[model samples]
Target: MQIHAHYNGAKPDPYLINHHLEDNRLSPESALKIIATSEPGGEAVGLPEFVFLNPQADPAPDKPLQYMIKELFVKETFRSAGTGRALMNWVIAHAQAAGCARMDWHVKPTNEAGIRFCRSFGADAVAGRVSFRLMLR
Candidate 1:
């Protein structure tokens, strides 16, 4: 997975996934949760498809808390099946309902499809913004 590959060449932390599942992060005030289900039984299909977001702390008091989309992805086969839109819609709706001033996410410039998808939702790319990270290891 891209996340696995990005973590300093180390595997993803299982504990983190467990913590996400166990926490209140999916509550209405936090982030919306979307789960793919099986056809017949309607059980969770699981894996390779999910969106994770959280309330972002905005420094500006005039702005309500913002929601940050931390991770979003759909299974390759389900890419165009409206799954991504559904997940995004859920997040947007909940964010608005939670009194968030805005929603934000980071997308790679080379991810043309992702850029288009975000644009389709009326998202604008902010100018002069860059992300930096320091590896503690």
Candidate 2:
């Protein structure tokens, strides 16, 4: 919720968030969600969500499956404590183990800290692309 507020300027409804998580849990092959804690059964201090795109669904038959990181959030208190880096490294390792072709994600243009962290991982921004959204609600 804090991450959503930070990126979207609003705190999303708890019910909606729960519904989304439940749906993801029901479809494990399509998405992966991780919660990080400081110790055994501790409170969650970080989360990372990933979506898998099956190569068979794409028109390009030769393409391999890809992983898309939908969100990576570490509580403000945990920022710069290596939590984010650890989560990213774990995700990358998981992807590699699954033989994923690549991993991709988007960062808000004004999120300088997020941008720096991503760049530190050797992520490059693609040019000539514009993000658009259509709200149905």
Candidate 3:
């Protein structure tokens, strides 16, 4: 199966993520919003089938209204096999193509999969990673 930019990605199958995340009400919706927008405003890489990446350019360039990301999730679907890796590889290649200095994200302290996933893309922590986010909405 070819990877298409699917919004809402196959309804958060029980096998994919922990059950609690799906029922968290806002998290799934937020995930939906990210998928729907295609260019999830805050994603380090704006939503698009493909986006231009530059390591030299600061990904989180402050825009008055435009959202940016520090800890972006490089999503992939397991069923499609290597699709997730494909997406991430593309992103990494894009970054190199655009001459990005580097890419990084902080995985959860306890998220072994997340850590593993990021490492698969050859990601490393340049500074303090594995922190917390206190979203007050």
Residues 1-137, model 2: lDDT tens digits: 78778778999998988887677654666456565556366868888887778755543444477888888888888889999999999888888887787888888898898899999998888688677889999
**lDDT (0-100) at residue 124 of candidate 2?**
85
Candidate 3: misplaced stretches above 4 Å? 1-80, 130-137
| TM-score (all chains, Cα) for each model | 0.64, 0.78, 0.41
lDDT of 3 by residue, 32-69 (tens): 22221233464232222322233334444432121212
2 or 3, which is superior by TM-score? 2
Question: What is the Cα-based TM-score of model 3?
Answer: 0.41
Residue 55, candidate 2: Cα error in Å is: 4.9
Superposed model 2: Cα runs more than 4 Å off: 9-16, 23-32, 38-41, 55-63
Ranking by TM-score: 2, 1, 3
Top-scoring candidate (TM-score): 2
- Ten-residue region with minimum lDDT total, candidate 1: 43-52
Question: lDDT tens digits, residues 1-137, model 1?
Answer: 33454434676678875577567555556445444434366633222223433334445455556676766766556677777787788778877777677877888888899899999999999888898879999
